[model samples]
Target: MKAIRIYEFGEPEVMRIVQVERPVPAPDEILVKVYAASVNPADYIIRRGGNEALKPLLKLPMGLGIDGAGIVEEVGSEVTEFKKGDRVYGVPNYLDGSYTEYLAAKATQFALMPRSLSFNEAGSLPACARMAYNGMVEKAKVQPGHRVLVHGAAGGIGSLAVQFAKAYGAYVIGTASAHNADFLKQLGADEVIDYNTQKFEHVVSDIDVVFNATPTTTVDEALRLRSVPVLNEGGIFVCTHGVWPSELFKGLLAKKKATVSMAGVDVNHHKIFTEVAKLIDLGKVKAVVNKVYPWERAAQAHHDSETKHVRGKIVLQIYQED
Candidate 1:
């Protein structure tokens, strides 16, 4: 089998397509003939060793992908939900490779591919879609009529966040560049702010919740939000990138400071991915695929995602069916 592996941490050049042994499924897992795979920010993060907590788990010359679509080649004895020849897509759990002709996945992380979508579209859903679902629905507890703001509105997670918030009936505000305003609006954002021309705080206020999808950039830009003092009292600010301990917030709470919460998403997506599949099946949501690359060009796929300007998901074709 062929797989994309990273030998060292640095630029996209570090990614290489190499020959590797085919993986076998666990008793509770399934072996899939991969049709396609999608690129996510986490793929690039793992490739560059940015997430230190995750480094110890990665084996050297590690396979670098999370989400993919495929047909079930074999199901483990312990698995009952899936069978050989079933069409599936999922986030592979603790594996040697997803960007390969054959990959293994835990049955828990997969769902039936939506009848309305192709393999490429299903490949684009697992990681980013689960991240967005956990953030918008579970953590933030976004409600209809609530005023919501999504940072990095044109990117993978942010684009889905916009759609989710809209479906839930929130008045959605999104921040992106001039080039993405129309795209953001098309995704159902009630208002799109060109972050380069105007700070989001200047144009919107009384926000009930702010979804910081681009936490890497949001920490520094937090100052830009101070100008807008109209956030609803007791409103929550969810910071996905930062870590805060209870002791760290004790003093701030004593001083009656504004509420700030640090959050981490569960990427397991075992159940959430199923729910997202339902949404796609029902036409309530869709994966936004901005670019597609051949499996051999996994390096270029990582490079494009690193740019941070990619409007939606980038997918890699692993195997083309007739």
Candidate 2:
């Protein structure tokens, strides 16, 4: 099988295509013939060796993707929810990455692809959608008439957060550059804040929720902190720092009297995707794919994700549905 591998970390160029023996499924696992995968900030962070500072050292020959959509080729003895030939999508245990031809993971990590979506659309859902769901529904519990603020609202997870907040009946305010204001409005944000010209905190305040969609490295403390006073009492602030909130960020939350929670997809990828699939099938949610690349260009996908300029999600087409 072919897979994207990183022997050492530095740049997108550090990722490469390599041939490896196909993995076998364990008793509770399923082997999938990958159809598509999405590029995430974590993929680039892993490729550039940034994770070493926070997590354990990256083992050499690591794979480079986290979430993917594919057809189940074989099911483990204990698997029951799906069978061979089922179209499935979710984040694989990417300790080895999902940028590959074949991946084997515990069957519980995947769910049937929403019938209303294509392989590319379902492929892009797992991580970004999960993050959005985590922030808007789980942490914020946004309800009808609530005010929700989504920072970096044109980006992948941010865009999804905007939609989910709106779907939950919240009045959503999304922050982005001027070019994305119209796009955010189309995604159902009640208001769009062009951070390039206007400060978000100045314009959006007394919110029920604030979802941070910026990468931890590029997050502006002043802009993000300004949101502290912008919240209603006990409002939730969700961070996508790619890790837990920093001690400093935590202290700000404490001082502001707003509780802070790091954004996270549910650990049970299957269950969450199943819920998201219901939204997809109901036409309440859609994957905000910005670009699609052929599978072989996994490196290029990583490069584009690092640019942080993409409006929504980026996907690598591993195969088309047959």
Candidate 2 lDDT: 0.83
TM-score per model over all chains: 0.89, 0.94
lDDT of each: 0.78, 0.83
TM-score, candidate number 1: 0.89
lDDT of 1 by residue, 238-264 (tens): 555534424434344334344555443
Per-residue CA lDDT of model 2 for 8-32, tens digit only, reads: 8787888778899999999899999
Total clashing residue pairs per candidate? 0, 0
The 10-residue segment of model 2 with minimum total lDDT is: 215-224
Error of 2 at 289 (Å): 1.1
Worst 10 residues of 1 by lDDT: 245-254
Total backbone clashes of candidate 1, pairs 3 or more residues apart or in separate chains: 0
- What are the clashing pairs of model 2? none
lDDT of model 2 at residue 225? 68
